[model samples]
Target: MNSNKAVFDSLRNNLKVHYDGKRFSYKSKHDLKDKSQLLVLIRKFPEGIAVIDLKDAYPNVMDDLQALKAVGQIWLLSNFDSQEDIAYPNDPRMVIKVDDDLKQLFPRD
Candidate 1:
């Protein structure tokens, strides 16, 4: 498990400034098949992280699913804000009509 520890350390080191403004910590372990050599689990501190059961954004993420673990977990690091301000389900296609709000942000300039 030393290699796993290294991965965890690397992840934490990289997240030092990415998960700011939160107050939690998460640790996960997973085994991978032939596709991926490693499958690490993600989680948020405490009970703030939401659990996404279905495969939406990343299907490969499910390879490390565990019944006792929480899915769609967020973190409370020092760089990431408690919440994100990005919009979702927005289209960038000008041919397809989009809401005025998204149109302004996703103009075809």
Candidate 2:
């Protein structure tokens, strides 16, 4: 299977994780004191899912993505316009393409 397929398959078989509308709750356990991108946070789980914002994301997204690959399988969501720009391995399943998705998740009340 390809990288995207691998991520989806893993998400299906492994445990499912949720986003708290903020940083992941398990950050403390993993010693991720510094603000990390959503990709980095997903690595905390043996396998998990999360929607990340490309705007406030970490600078070294590439490194974070590599780290996730090492830990296990993962699927991420982002507001990226071009999939080719970030799809290093060309794993479409690795990222969920969504525009204004995060805004809806966290609306201004």
Candidate maximizing TM-score? 2
TM-score of each: 0.18, 0.23
| Model 2 Cα lDDT, one tens digit per residue, 65-93 | 65655654443434355442221122435
lDDT (CA) for every model shown?
0.33, 0.42
| Local distance difference test, candidate 2 | 0.42
Report the alpha-carbon TM-score of model 2 versus the true structure.
0.23
Steric overlap count per candidate? 12, 0
Error of 2 at 36 (Å): 6.4
lDDT of 2 at 60: 59
Cα-based lDDT at residue 8, candidate 2: 48
lDDT digits (tens) for residues 1-109 of candidate 1? 2348676556556533233334224323222242122222232123232223222324464443332223222222222453422211112232354689987886485
